[model samples]
Target: MVLDTVMTTLHVLTGALWVGSVVFVAGVVLPAALDGSLDAAPLETFADRLVYGSRAASVVMFLTGGHMAGTGYTFDLLLNSSRGHLVLAMLLLWLVLSALVEIGRSRLVEGLQEKRVRSPARNAMGVFRAAAVVGVLLLVDAGLLASDVALY
Candidate 1:
């Protein structure tokens, strides 16, 4: 029981870290950064820090999945099981995309830091848009997967 709980906590933490950073960049920071004269250096540096952390969290989430799966849990129970195959699959996909976003953000930040700003805000805004689009896809996937699962 305790092991299951611990694994679940790790999964949730990493997922939150991934989601939170994306939300901050897409829903708040990027738009504001676009409209203002905030120095690219600070924003680039900050994005560097966030990219590293979220990527690490994504790794943890992936690592935890192996052990969670070894427990002989039935797959695709999804939200019904709270910690099942469907959840893990979705998490895996999310992680992959999160890593992609991190890579894009990292490259853009590096460009800005190198005085290679081909428009930092515009480039960053593109990354943010991609993240938003991925977020919506994840939602739709989850809803479709949950179609037959009973909810209270």
Candidate 2:
């Protein structure tokens, strides 16, 4: 029971870190870059941290989430219940958000490599916006699952 609690806490923290970072980058950093207020050097550094932080968080979330699912749910339960459906949706949303971050980061990196700002920031903003939306959905789905809200 204690182990489950620990795993759940870790899972939630990592999710928050991942979602928060993406939102910060999309809403704050990228906007600054697009407005010519930020330089490539700092942006590159931030992007590096964001990429690595995201990767570490992803691994932690995956392990913790798998542990939770393994301990609390069976294959049958995962496939047959509304809560299970939410879990599946969470997984899908995670994948989508991860991909969006990767793509956005790539665009930013490519632009930074050329010492350019506004173009890359503009290119990535749309993807990051989509990711933010999905991140919110993922959080909402988790909340619904936790609150025992029935969805059919």
lDDT (Cα, tens digit) per residue for candidate 2, span 46-130: 9888888878887897899899889878898889999788888888998898888888889888989889999988988999899
Off by over 4 Å in 1: 72-85, 114-118, 135-152
lDDT (0 to 1) per candidate: 0.66, 0.88
Locate the minimum summed-lDDT window of 10 residues in model 1: 143-152
Error of 2 at 61 (Å): 0.8
Q: Pick the candidate with the highest TM-score.
A: 2
Clashing pairs in 1: none
Per-residue CA lDDT of model 1 for 1-152, tens digit only, reads 88877986786666656666776777777676667645677777768877787778767867775566666355445435643645665766676667567766865686576665446667767666677667565555456444835232
lDDT of residue 26 for candidate 2:
86
What would the TM-score be for candidate 1 when compared with the true structure?
Answer: 0.71
RMSD of each: 4.5, 1.3
83, model 2: CA deviation in Å? 0.5
Residue 123 displacement in candidate 1 (angstroms):
1.6
Top candidate by lDDT: 2
